[model samples]
Target: MQLEITGHHLEVTESMSNYIREKAERLKRHFDQVMKIHFILEVEKQRHKAEATFHVNGNHLFADAYADDMYAAIDALTDKLDRQIVKHKEKVKDHHRQEAAQLVAATETTD
Candidate 1:
């Protein structure tokens, strides 16, 4: 998956980019369908904000967090998105499994 990181008020440094990259890579463990991730980091006064937008299939999952520091903000946002990805994955897998079973039962009954 492609990861695009940008900053509004703060300079996008190598360490910042690496941190975002490292954090985003963990999402692949949840769903390999993740196509791209867009991260926007900005500092609003004393609050450091991190927002991540995950592009998967035709859907998008967005998570944002703000803290006194940028790294902490990114970490919190990553954790939030992690939970969302896991939940979505389970829902889709279960739904598809149920559909497949129903289809197999219907075909067997017809025969």
Candidate 2:
């Protein structure tokens, strides 16, 4: 997957980029259909904010976080995205199974 990181008011450092790379790899492990990810970091006074938009298969997932430190915000953002990715995976995998089962049951009852 492709990753793009942009800063709003601060310059992104090598260390921060590496940290985000590691987190993104972890996310890729959870779902392989991830196509692209765009991350935006912003600093306002004392708040550090991190937001990400994930393009997966044909759908998009988004999550944002705020913390006292940029690293902490990134961590929280990853956690939230992880949950959303897992939920999406489940929905994609199970979307048809339930309907197929219901159809089978209805046919059996009619016979």
Candidate 3:
């Protein structure tokens, strides 16, 4: 997966980038099909905001968080994204299971 980090009002340092990358790896563990991820960090007055757009297959998932600290905001953002990805994975799995069950029922009825 590709990761791009952009800063709006704050300069992104090496440590900050590394921190985000490390947190982002947890997302990959949940869903390996992530195609690309774009992270936006902004500082507006006293609020530090972190936003992420995840590209997975044909779907796009977005999550954002705001806190007094940038690191905290990033942590929250990743957590939200992780939940979304897991939910998406579950939906996909259930969809295939439902389809297979319907197919089996149809074959049994015909036999």
CA lDDT of each candidate?
Answer: 0.91, 0.97, 0.95
lDDT of 1 by residue, 1-111 (tens): 889998999899999998888888887887989999999999999999999899987679999999999999999999999999988887666577889999999999999
Which of the two candidates, 1 or 3, achieves a greater TM-score against the reference? 3
- Give the CA lDDT, 0 to 100, for residue 75 in model 3: 96
Against the hidden true structure, what lDDT does model 1 obtain?
A: 0.91
RMSD after CA superposition, every candidate: 3.0, 2.7, 2.6
Candidate ordering by TM-score (highest first):
3, 2, 1
> How does each model score on TM-score?
0.84, 0.86, 0.86
- Tens digit per residue, CA lDDT, model 3, 14-75: 99999999998999999899899999999999999999999999699999999999999999
Clashing pairs in 1: none
Q: How far is candidate 1 from the true structure (C-alpha RMSD, Å)?
A: 3.0
Q: Rank the candidates by lDDT, best first.
A: 2, 3, 1
Lowest-lDDT window of 10 residues in candidate 1?
88-97
lDDT of 2 by residue, 1-111 (tens): 899999999999999999999999999998999999999999999999999999999899999999999999999999999999999998889668889999999999999
Off by over 4 Å in 1: 96-111
